[model samples]
Target: MLVTERTLAREIAPAVERSLPGVEVLAVEMLSPSRFCVYVDHPEGVDHALCARVTQLLDDYRASYTIDVSSPGVERPLRKPAHFRAAVGQEVQIRTATPLAGKKRFRGAVVAADERHLRLAAGDEAVDIPYEAIVRGNLIDEGQVQP
Candidate 1:
């Protein structure tokens, strides 16, 4: 997601949490400049269809600002460390904001990942990549989004 949108979500998440108790937001992302995707790891038996409508209602009820919500696309990027861990032994493409070894990109098998950093097995060597350096990372699907 864009910085502005992330800021907005962080500002609104507390309110969302209060209104929708026990609804844990799993992830949020921007699909495009105007589209925002929100994923909630909600409690079972909650009416998702109603929840979606309620979300729309909330956006409409609030006249000052608005947010659009939707599901993750067919392919989703790894947004957390657990996502990285789940991709162990899988090929992945990662991009960083700052250059690492003169570049901001790398692709290799995910060796390990935790809250702190990601370790990628690139050829015979393993490289430790700090989380702050990661711009985005996703499992490499030959026919899917690389990063």
Candidate 2:
């Protein structure tokens, strides 16, 4: 039987949610054959204790592979519609499956987002990108001043 990354996420997400009711499973990525990364968050915030609890809950599944529990961090990935909605008014970087406005990559502030598409203000230009077309999206941490 082949257990893919999605399967692992589906199996583990419930257990994690059950153990920590308020915790949200942001993403599950397979970094290598034996290493998996789990990104989680809570309304209050993620801390060492929360990470430890998640690790403890996933002990059984860890027998065959390594699990690294972590917070989403500054550059949090936007994977779902809800994530995009939450990111409104924040700087974002998006890569579409195909070019939308003569380009595949876009970086700007998300002005609005809905179930179907999101509006991004890239300087003087505003681009509307549909949810299905987004291959990857992440919030840009603007607090770090660039030199």
RMSD for each model, in Å, please?
4.3, 3.4
lDDT of 2 at 130: 98
Worst 10 residues of 1 by lDDT: 65-74
lDDT at 143 for candidate 2?
A: 90
Tell me the spans in candidate 1 whose CA falls farther than 4 Å from its real position. Answer: 12-26, 31-34, 39-54, 57-70, 142-147
Looking at model 1, the pairs that clash are none
Query: For candidate 1, lDDT tens digit of each residue in 39-133?
Result: 55454533657358537645743464344544333344665687788778888888887887777898899888889888988899778888767
lDDT (CA) per prediction: 0.66, 0.86
For residues 14-130, could you state the per-residue lDDT of candidate 2 as single tens digits? Answer: 889887989988777678888888889999999999999999999997888899999999989786789999999998999887899899999999999999999999889999999
- Give the candidate number with the greatest lDDT: 2
TM-score of 1: 0.63
